[model samples]
Structure formats: C-alpha cells, structure tokens
Target: MTTNEFIQKLDGLFAAQEYGKVESFMLSALEEAKEKEDYGLYLSVGNEMIGYYRSISRFQKAYQISEDMLLLMEELQMDQSAEFATVLLNTATAYSFDENFEMALRFYRRAEQIYHLLVSPDDYLFAGLYNNMSSLMEKMDRNEEALDLLMKALAILKNYPDRQMEAATNFTNLGLLYLKTGDCNSGKKCVMQAIGMFEALDTPASHYSAALSALGEICYHEKDYEQAVIWYERTLEEIKKHYGFNLAYAVVCENLANVCREMERQGQAQEWLKRASEVRKRLEGENSGELHDIDNTAAVVNKEEKTVKTGGTKQKALERCREYYERYGKPILKQFPGLQGHFAAGLVGEGSECFGYDDSISADHDYFPRFYIWLDDEAYEKYGEELRAAYQKLPRHFEEFADTVMTPEAVSRCGVWKTTDFYHRLLGRQTPPETMYDWVSLQETRLATVTNGEVFEDCGGGFMAQREVYLSYFPEDVRRKKLAARLRKMAQMGQYQYARCMMRGEYVAAQMALAEFIQNTGSACFLLAGQYMPYFKWMHRKMKELSALSEVAGKLEKLALLPSQQDKWDEEKPERYRFALNTADEKVALIEEIAGRIAVELRRQGLAEGKDSYLEPYAAEVESRIEDPVLRMANLV
Candidate 1:
C-alpha cells in the first residue's frame, strides 16, 4: 500500500478505538517505514503505537516499544528534539499506569528535563506533562504540590483554547485537584466548563465520556442530584456505545446506583448496581474485586453483614458451609476434574447441627462446624475415602471454634456420605417414595429436620434434586390419611378413653390417658396446619407457635397443670389417709373440651364432616377425603 493511504488507514483504526487492529497496522507499518528508510515516519508512527498501548493499559508493551525506539534513535544518529521528549513522556505515563510509581517518577523527571532543554515552559506539551505529574502527586497525598502542578498546566492550556482535547483534560485534572484541596465551588466550575467544551465537540468520544463523568461527580457534590443523574446516564451511554463495557462503565453504573438510592428510588438503584455486578462478573469472573464492590449495594437489603456479625446463628453456619464450598469443595473438583459432578457438599439432615439449633450447651456433644459431602453409591465406593481425606484436611476448627467430640457413629452425620444412607438415616428409606402408603408412615418431625437447613453446593445435582422431591407437599390423599390417623388416636386416648378412665374412678390411669391425649392431639393440630412437627422436646413449643390450632396448646398446658382427681397433698395428710380433691369430673370435662376444639377445627377445614364433640366420628370423615384408594385402605392409627 502507498504511504499516505497506509497512514490514513492507521489513523482510521486509531480513531475507531480498535486497539487490536491498531497494533496490527503498527507492526506492518514499522516494517514499511524501515523498508523505505524513513526514520522520521518510523519514529512518529512508533510513538503513536506506544501511546495507544498506554491508553489501553498495556504498559509492558508500551515500555518495550520505548526501549526499541531509543535503540533506533541511537543507531540512526537522531537529534535531540520535541519527538524525543514525547517518547519520554509517553514512557513515563505508561509506568505510572502500571503503578510502578518509583520508575514512573524517574521517567517523568527525565521527560521534564528533556522538555525544559528543548521547549518553553508555556508550551502545550509541557502543560500535559504537569497535568500527568499532578495526578501522581495527588495519589501520594502531596496535595499542595499537585495543586501547583495543575495550576501551571491550566496556565499553559488557557493560552491554547483551540486545543479542545488538551483544554478539556487540563480542566478535568484541575477540577480533581480542587476537589482534593476541598475547594468544592472551584471544582464544580472547572468540571462544568470541561463538560461544556466536550459536549460541543464531535470527535474524541473518550474525552466526552471522561468530561461527563467529572460533571457527574461535581453535580453530586453540589447536591444537584437531578443533574448528576442526567450526566451519569449520558456518560454510561457513551461508554457502552463507543468503548463497550469496561472499568469506566462499571464505575458510572455504581455511582448512578448510589445516587438513585439517595433519591429513594431503591428498586432502580439496586437494578443499576446489579447490572454493574453482572458486567464485572462477565469481564473478570470470581477473580475481580469489582464484583465485591457492588455486592452490598446491589442487594435491596443486604443482610449478610448483619447476620455474620451475630455469630452462632443458623445464618452463620450456612455462611460457613458456603465459604467451605467456595474454598475447598470447589477447588478440589477444579484440581481433580474427574471429581466434578461426582460428589456434592452441603449442610443438611435432621441433626440439631443441620438445623443450626446447637448452641454452646448443645454443641458440647455432636454439634460441629461441618457439612455433608454426598456421592452416588458408585462414587462413594470408588472415591469415598479419598474425598473424605480431602475434607479432613480442611481446618478442623472453623475460625478457631472447635466442633463437638466426634465419634465413629457421627462420621456420616457431617462428612462425605452415600446418598442412600443419608436419606435413610432421617427418612427411613433408600430413595424417594413411590406410593401413598410410603408417605403414610413417615414422621412429621423427620420431615421438618430434613427440609430445615441450606444446601451449599450441589454439583452432582443428585443429592439436592432428591431433597427437592421430598420438599414437595404431600399428596392430598396422603395428607388426609395422616390427618385421619392423628384424629383417630386423639379421639381414642383423649376423648373416649380419658372419660372412660375418669368415670371408673381410675384417676391415676386417667392422667396417663390425658398425657397420651395431649401428645396425639398436638400431633393432629400440626397435621391440620399442614406443618411438620419438630422433635418431641420442642414439639409443644413449636406447636404453640403454629398459626393454626395454636390455642389448643394453652388447653393442653392447663390439663398438665391440673391437680389429680384422687390424690392431692398426701404427704401433708395423716400418715394412714391422704386428702382427695375429687376433681375427676372437672378433669374429664377439660379432656372432652380440648378434643371437641380439635374436632371443630377439623370440620372447619373441610377435612372432616361431623358435628359431634367426639373425635372418632370425624376420623371417618377425614379417611373418606383420602384421594389415594390404596392409602385409604391403610389402618387409621
């Protein structure tokens, strides 16, 4: 290609901001420049490539180019000139971009010396140098020196108003300097002037985006929120349309989200932050700090920090499990690619630890900062011990908090376990049930325990997917059967049997019947509410907390507190004879009253069809609603 045409093509690529194409053109153009023995053109084009690399944060390449150019200059007997100063300045800025501040300062001083030797202090080239150095000084907290440098930059830039891009950059840096010095008014004016200049131009879209961002910050500081929002939106649009989603786009998104939040547009604010998070995640994956930057703001109400600080909560345990999965569990699969999809790690099961109810006292035994890692039976046989050993290497104490005294029986409770046994331990079956009769006999407390906690990583999808099936609400027929069984037992023990024992003056036996009555009736109350009961120790407490039939809890409490009908204050009475309360009729009446209340709740729920206070009649109504014919044939209690 001809020289003029080739240079124009390179210019077009640079203007398009296509750095890959720019690099390619420079590589070919360097050969062409060398072939024609055009030293001036070669040096100029090489300088452009170096600046382009620095612009895109490719600092190493930019530094290498400067070294190559210096060698060529020495070989070609190049004179000391403005071009040499440009190369020095570009190299200095490249080092600064990489945060090699010491190296950057050395190059900047060298470039300053070269510029002073060859040019006036008032020249635009010298002006840009001061602006660049000011930024470095500002980062070092040398604010006074940074301010002096920016003022010097503006003094030179004001002499060249037609240098639109240069003037805009000087203003941006000066405004930032003023901001650093706490001169908010001066900062706003400088930033606003830069934005006005940038908006009036059509070329140098990056200058416009930068100027817009500066205006956004100034307006935000002034509390002119509407203007800040407008400017930030414009800057974001420019970045997306011209430069794609980069670091600048993410920053603008975060600022816009913050502004929207202060304006009480919570949903809009969270959405913007979420968009910013997604962009960061797409660009850098889990390796990016940018994702962490947006996480707290991106959620509408971030509770993680709150829950983490309140240590020993269930959330704390879940967080620990999640951290473990992200650390050891995920990395193990990454290193052993064959193990991917072979096993799963999570917190689950009916153990108190699984439910996160184990406090300091309860934690003395089986509680631990541990979770289960489940595998299919085949995987368990093949890689079981290997994977278990891997988990054993994890820090024994999570954050210096020791777990319980673990034993051989507790091994499968928290570590790598077979899926069949994991389910069977709590669920009493190998896999998910196939029929209504299977559901008929499962304990409700077991259901609650199995479904209570979080699952951290389900790579295999085998273990968690099975749990999903278990979480499904029981079939209408199975629910009715379980409800019917509970009702039948409550009626036999509390309503019929208790009264029968009381009428026979068997008050001691009557209390036993009353205790059975309370247990069965509470179980029925939980069934009627469609809630699984917890373990027996917490059953009464949990039942009282249920939204449905909770008042029945109060009645059961009164029954337990009542004095026995035939025996009272026997130790305080005569040695041969004891005092009697003769409250058998009152005790029987309370039993009937509690049982009748349950029957009333059942009929109200349309789970039964009866008006009698006796619960046995309602059991038949409950059984009739059983949709599964085979399950309906099962025994009531």
Candidate 2:
C-alpha cells in the first residue's frame, strides 16, 4: 500500500485498539514512507505509532515518537492541517496520561488554536477539546474552571446535529460536575437526560453503560439504595456483556456492593461484596489501600462484634459530622450551587482506632469527632486550605466532643491529598518513573503501604479510577516491551552467565549469579504487579498469599546471610549441602511463583500470561551446580 494509505489504515487499527499489530505494520510502512519521501504519510504514520504506544501506555515511547512527529510537522509546516491538529490533541492526551499537565495544556491550547482555524462553526471536534480541557482542569483541582468549560462544551454540543455520542458524553460529564458541585437535582437531570439519549440512540455503544453507571451514581448519592442497586445492576450486566469485565465493570461491582451494604441485605451484600473483592483482587492482583474498606465492610456484614464502642460515641461522632455537613456544607453549596459529586462524613480508617479496632485505649491526643474534607486533587490544591479553615470554624467544641479541633496543619495532613502526594507516598514518586527497578520498587512499596487513612472518598471514581491509573496493568505494547526486555535480560544473565560462572569454578561469582537470578525473578514479580496490581494493598497481599514462595520470604532472608563458601568451602558437608540444595530449590520455587503470578494476572486481564510451560527454565542452573562442585557454593553474595 502507498504510505498515506498505510498510515490511514494504521490509524484505523489504533482506534480499534489493535495495538499488537501496530509495530509490525508501522515498521514496514515507515520504511516505505521514508523511501518514497512522503512527508505527509511520514507524519501520519509517526503520529499513529505514537497513538498505539499511548493506548497501551508506553508514555516514554509515545513522547519520544510525538517529539519526532512534532519536529517533522514543523519541518513540513504541516501544523495547518486538520490531521496535524488531531495529532497535537492526541499527543496532549498522551502527556495528560502521564500527569504532565504543563506540556499537555500547551499542546491542547495549540490544538484548540488549530482546530478553531480548521473546523466549521457547528463541528463537534471542539466539543471534544472542551471536554478534554474540562477533565484536565478537574484533575488540576480547577473546579470552577472545569465547570465553566463543561458548560461551554454542553452549549456547543447542543448546537451540533449529528453528535449524539459526544452530546451524551457531555451531558454525563455535566452531570458528574453538578454532582460534584452539590447540585444533585441538576446532576440528576443531566444524568437522566444522558441516559435517555443513550437509550434512544438505537445503537450498541459503550456510552449506554457509562450513562447507566452515572444514573447509578446519582441514585447512590441520593441515598436511594434500591434504585441505585437497579441502575448499578444494569450497568454491570451491560458492561460485562458489551465491554467485558474491566476497571469500569469493577467500579459498578463496588457500587453495587456498597448499595447492598446500605440496604442491610447482608447476605446479598456479602455476595456482591465478594464479587467486588474478586474483581478488585483480579484487577489489582495485589493488596492495595481498598483492602481496609473491603475488610471493614466484610466485617460489618459478617456481624463481627466490635471490640470497642464506648457508649455510642462512634454513632454520636458520626451524627455530629453529618450535622455539620448538612448545615455548613449546604451553605457552602449555596455559594457554589454546582457541587454535587460527593458528600460523605466518616472516620472509617486511618486513625488509631482503625488499626487498633478499639476505642477504649485512648482519646488522649487529637482524637475527637474529626472528619475529612475531600476534594479532587485540582480542587484541593486550589481551595483546600480555605475548605479546611471553613471546616474548623464550624462549632468544633460540640457537647461531649469539645475536644474537637481542626488545625490547618492537621487538616492539611489529614484530609484526602492530591493524587501526586498519594502516589508518591505509596509508590515513591508522583509519576511512575521509567526503569525496571523503579517500576518494581514502586509497585512493591505501593502495594505494601497504600492504606493509612480515614479517607472521605468524595472523589467519585475514588479507589476505582485510581486503581485503573496506577494499579491497572501496563498497556499491551508496554507490557510486550517490558516482557521483551526481561526475557532478554534473563536469557543473557540467567541462562548464560550463571552456567559460565559455575563451569569456571567461580563459586562466589556463581552464587552471585544465583542471587542475581533471584533478584531478577523478584523484579519480575514487581513487573506482574506493575502490569496488573490495582490500588489496594490487600489485593497484593492476597496474590502473595497465594504464591508458593510467599511463605519463604523468611528463607530467602536467611539465604542472604549464610557465609560465602569460598576458602574453606566443603560442598560435601551435610549442612552446607542441605543449605545449598535448599537455597537452589527455593530459588526455583520463587521463579515458579513469579511465573505463576504473571500467568494468573495476564489470564485475568485476558492476555497471554506466560508462554513457559513450567518454571524450570526460569530457575537457577541446577545441572551446572552438579557438574562444577566449587560453583555449588551457598549464599555467597
């Protein structure tokens, strides 16, 4: 095919999420485009390749390709073309995914400029730009700005004739905005309208699911648990049938679980809760922060008696928080009149009581009827201190809860923080860093320590969206890229170097190879987690709980300590031989465990988890150990 034809075809495949086919086709197509000196086709193919990289979330590769594409576009002075505008918008989206807000905003504005110059008055493309801009504003906590932009998009959508899907999306977004701003009525109106449009559209589209989900969210906020359950059930079914099970499906499951809990249908709630847990577990594949939420809910549903409840103090505290929310919260809403997304008050987790599961111990310090004030990262950054101050001024010394206080510093430390802080604390960085070691360590740390809060998850998607962003597996192409790298590393080091060291009687070096193999395999576990581990610690714990090597973390610890078998080494010693064999066996087990986890996570994601039939190939070189006695050293490195 001609380069332009090939580029167009590749763009079509990318839109279809056929990411796997992108590289092979693009390599050949790019070759042809370069050979034919087709600048337009070259730009198209380059941008399309960037999109493919982005969809699977290879941000670095996407950015690299985008830079090259942008330079080429500049070289050709092709920024005036509609295709170039679209490419700029797409590249901005790539930056947004990585939380590179500044760069994303730059590209988005540039695209808007180009789009305005290119498209006609009633075109729907601007609707998309506005929607995207609004979303970014929301992410940045620019609530008022986001709302204004959303309204503008709604206005534009209303003028468009053949943009039902975009219109529905706009309405849904508006509904969510209204819900966030405290205008539930307006939110409901917008959501139901969107749902109506979706039903009337007469096509099998994903927006119907999104609309149903939005309606469910509205019902949930209204405390209409029964209606909420119905909407959520429909959404769940539609999502599973049409989109299959994914992060969105998992979200509906969580909402359904919550609805069931609210309705006091403990049995049904438990069932749905279990389903939600499984979905969460499968999605995250490792324990994450949401584990505490699940554990608390499960405990409540299971009728486990609380260890401590001092004279209905808990209930009284909840009541006070609710009262404040109803009173002062409403007044605040009157001022904005568009806040409707989330309104909750609780002290569920992240306090002394949460971990202790008892109240009798101490209220000595700062423990009172304290409540969290949650806003999305964007809003929090802009108006968090103001909100905190406002919350503090609200009758802090209530009756017996006179010890109540809301210090600004305390609130700053206490309330739901920005995604950046949340991720950095959990994952060791604001953005997922680029490198295997960084990925592994971050996954381990994030999975190990995400839940330490009495989070007022007024952020609608809450744990759900966060899970998708951080915990969700790497996009396919990214996974393939990482997998290829890992395979290459393993082949070079594990398959070749270890055997060579053993053959050369380099016992110390051989042990080092074995240690390297274990570390690499452990790193692979992190890869699996990075790719599939969701935003909950408990889910990660569960995966580790299921692993064969999980029980042997202690053994591996000991293996790290056994003295090197160098000068006075005797492989014939029973204790040394036992340790060596056992260590080797355990290393094999660890590799197998990592492989198993990878396979399970991939299968859950509906991707091929692993091609290896067994873990033997990934295990330490047992044959080489036997042939070279000196190399069969124990715990050298």
Candidate 3:
C-alpha cells in the first residue's frame, strides 16, 4: 500500500479505538514496506510506530525505533531532508519523555537547524517543531526561552484555521509555564482559554481533563481550597467518563485528596485517598510511583488523625532546637571546659528551620534536634571532631521528636564546624565582602542566612563578630547602586513592559513583567529598609515584618493574584471591552501607586532628589547619588 493509504488505515484503527491491535499492525506494515523496498512507506510506518509507542509511554521502544529509522534515512542519503527532520523531532520528543533531556536537546537543535534551511518561518512544520522543542526547554528549566518559543509557535499556528487544536495545546503549554514561574493570573487565563477551545472543538476528554487539572493546581497553590476541589472533581469526572479507572483518574483523585486534606476535611480526604489507592492498585500495580504517592498521602492522613487525638500542636523546629540545646548541648559543651570559651553554638544556615519558617511539612527531612557549634579555626583543629563525636552521643529522642532520617544532602547542616568553614560554605568566602563591588554582588539571601537565628552562646565572640559585619546591611554606596538597579527594573518591567505587553495581547508576558516588577519592588523595599531579603520563599513573609514600607508587600501580593482581563479583551461586546479597559487601568494605576510609594521612600532616605512619581527618574537620581564612581558608572541593572 502507498504511504497515504497506510496512514488512512492507521487513522481508522485509532478512530475505532482498537488500541491493542495498533502495535502489531504497525510492525507488520513496517516489515512489509521494508520487504517491498518502498522507502516512503517504510519511513511513514516507522514514524507512526514511534508516535504510537510514545503515546503508550513505551519510551524505550519508541527510542529504539527512532534510532533505526534515522539510520535507514541516512543510509538512503535522505539525512538532510524534511522527512529526516520530522524523524529527528519525533526522536527528540521520545528522548524527552524518557527524561534524557540533554540528548533530547541535541536532537531538537539538529532538527531546528534543518527546518530553518528547508521551511518557511510560518510553516506549520516549524510550529510543530517549536511547540515540541519548547516542551524540552521547559523540562530543562530554561523557562524564558521556552515561553518565547511557545509564543512563536502560537503566532504561526494562528495562521492555520485547521490547526486550532494545536493552538489550544500551545495555550495550555503557555499557561503551565506561567504557573511554573509563579504568574498565576496569566496561567489561569491561558488555561481557561485552552479549555474553552477544547470544549468548542469537542476534542478528546483527556485534553479537557488535563486543563481542568491545571486549573485545580493553580487553585491549590493559591489556597483556594473550595475552588481547587471543584476543578479537581470536574477533572476526575471527565477522566472517569472517557478513560475509566486509568492512571490519569488515579492522579486526579490523589490531587483531590491533597486539597481535601489542606481544607481539613479529613473524612472527605480519606474517601478520595481510598479511591485513588484502589484505582492505583488495579491500574498501576503495587510497585508504581502512583501507588507509593497514595501510600504517603494515607500515612499523612493517619498522622494527622493521631495528632488530633493526642491534642498536640506541632512544635516549631527552632524552639525544639533551643530546648534540646538547653537539655543536652550546654552540658555537653561543659564537658569540654578548656574549650568552652572558644565555642559558639546556634541553629543557623540552610534550612527552613534556621529561618524559623519550618512547619509540620519540614519533618520529612532535615528536621531534627540539631544546632551548629562553631569553633575558632585553631580550636576546631584541636577539638572539632571530638566535639562532634560527643554531640552524636546525646539522646536522639527528645519530647515527641527524634533524630530525623536524613538524606545525603542534609548530613552536614548541623554539627561541629570551624567558624570560618561554616561561613565559607554559605557565602563562598570566610569573611564579609570588603569591596563595594563585592557587597553589590553578594546575594541578599546569603546575607540573610548569615544573620538569621539566635546565637545561643558566643563566649569568644568570634562567630558573632564575623556575622555582625554581614548584619550591618550594605554600605550606603552599594545600597544606592542596588536600589537604583531595582528601581530601573521596576520601571522597565512594571511601568513600561507590562502595559506594552497587555496592549499587544501578550498576557503571559505581561504577567511575567508584573511578577518581576513585584519581585524587584520587594527587593527595593528591603534595600530601603536597610535589610537583607531572605530567600524567595521567605521574602514576602519577612517583608511583612519590615517596619519600613511593610504595606507594600500586601499591595504586591494583590497585584500578583489579580484576575486576568483576557476574557473581556477577547469579548466583542462594548461593555466587556470597557470592563477590560477599566481593569487594565486599575492594574497600571496600582503599578504606578507602588512606584509612587517607592519614590517617596527614596526621597525620604535622601537617596534620590526627585518629586516625580515615576520610578525611572528616581532610579537615575539614586544612581547619581552613588559616591562610588565605579558603581555609579556601571549599568543600572
């Protein structure tokens, strides 16, 4: 049979949902084409087989066939053709599914190079390539690059009316990317659009269910438990309606159980957990990751039930450390009478517990009765190992807590260390930054880590002395340069690009611009308050505690969670258009209001000489106040 005739028969089988027959039929076709010496039919059958195997998650089989197909193409002197590029794209996707990301990227790039030579910019082939390659980029954590490629694919796909499903898939991909980057507004908008498109086209239920699950995820992260449960239930129903008790159904059931647990509806949570466990057992077997995850959720539910029965509240890890220290650590150190004055002990460095942010969830790893003991370099050389051994001999169980089962990464977080080495591990240097450039380059989070937690004792004052240097905040010049850079970013991302992207209908890009604006504005607030911003996870929590510009954190959070105006923007009704325009105006006004607040703080601090509400002029003024000519002359951002 000809390639077209074979493809028609394959499509008929797929449409009939005769999935069990697909593999054998495709293999027979492939062999028959090979026997007939029909290269076109053979390549066509090979591509079909690769896609079929990949769809069934048989990635090794798909990859093996892809290798065979490529070798055959090269042997036939067809290595540079569009057909070869198509095979390369399929191979790359197979590798990606198998989690061999670097190899996937290599194949993707080779295919992209061939496509650039053989295809037009707006070709549907290029769109497919871009869409597939974007998935690989996202998996590799190159999010900005992934976003750009997805946008390119969307732009090209928009020109092909028959490719609406592809365009909708791109929207789904874009939404997930935005969600990954914490741009929930854009993510929700894109996902909703994809769902709408899928519904209108009457596409496969799986496509619709996936989008619903994504929406459920967004709600879960936003703490909208009611809405999360709603979306997840709908997704579960969709999956059950078409796919029965499959892995997707099990996963959605698991998601609902998690949301129910978060809502404290333990009975409902247990019901969902049981459902998921039952489906997982039948569909995925006992050894599957899905089963393992369900087992974990069941364990957590049982733990919470036990906690409730005991009338106990989870103790903060820092408090536990101090109590443990008082009970054991102090007496242990007293055993080393000669070295007592040389030791400084505290719980600090590289854990949520150190920052006092640890919760019940943290106990799975690195949450134990642990604290650091710092010794002077010479004292450590003499007694560090001895002290560590003594520390290990302490009672492992205290109160309701015990020594945690630690991963390899959590081994050294607590223990005896030379004072210099502890700081070196965290900051990549034993001493504080000595130069203006060094201060500017030092990550604020690193400084925050160095200064966090209580120094329980410091008889020699060595550890605290070194920490004091970091606690002093940035020098005035370095602060000005950093503040100026943050202001410039706020101006560019929030005040300028946000509006520009909105006008261009690039809602995802607009949301990213706003997210950056919020981030930099938060950083600027910390700079203005003469504080180090903690890690990203804790920045908002710490910002709310700042005496200076504390209200700005709430405003930034409001801006981030604002609902997208995409529906109104696409609406033809005049009232809807007006509503979208009004929302857009409100958002811009909020952005400027934030800028205005920062501008006032700048003048109050005497870092800038401007009454203007716009941040760019204030940024320029702040840069001008930098006494260090080197930083003043450097790029603003």
lDDT per residue as tens, model 1, 195-312: 7787677665466787788788878888888899998988876775554566567778899878877777776776676667566555533344443443454454232222212213
Local distance difference test scores for all models: 0.70, 0.56, 0.78
TM-score of 3: 0.49
Per-candidate count of clashing residue pairs (backbone under 3 Å): 0, 29, 0
Per-model TM-score, in order, reads: 0.48, 0.42, 0.49
**For candidate 3, lDDT tens digit of each residue in 157-256?**
8789887788888888889899999999999999999889888874353467778898899999899999998898788767655445565677777888
Listed per candidate, the RMSD to the true structure in angstroms reads: 31.8, 17.1, 24.5
- Score candidate 1 by lDDT: 0.70
Worst 10 residues of 2 by lDDT: 619-628
Candidate 2, residue 408: Cα displacement in angstroms equals 28
Give the per-residue lDDT digits (tens) of candidate 2, residues 1-637: 6655785786576457664566888878877877888776777678767765554445556656665565466557675777777777877776675565645676788788788898874467887888888877776667899898888887888777688888888788788888888899998999888888877775555667877888898999989888998898788767655434455666677777687778776666655555565555544444433334433433444343323223222533444545555665556544532334533333433334433232443354455545554445655666657666666666645545545344454443344345555555546576554543344344432443343333433435143344435433443334334443453354445444544554456877867776665455444444433323223323333334322124334444554555543433323354554344222433334434444544443332223423452333322322122232432332221
For residue 183, what is the lDDT in candidate 3? 96
lDDT of 2 at 64: 60
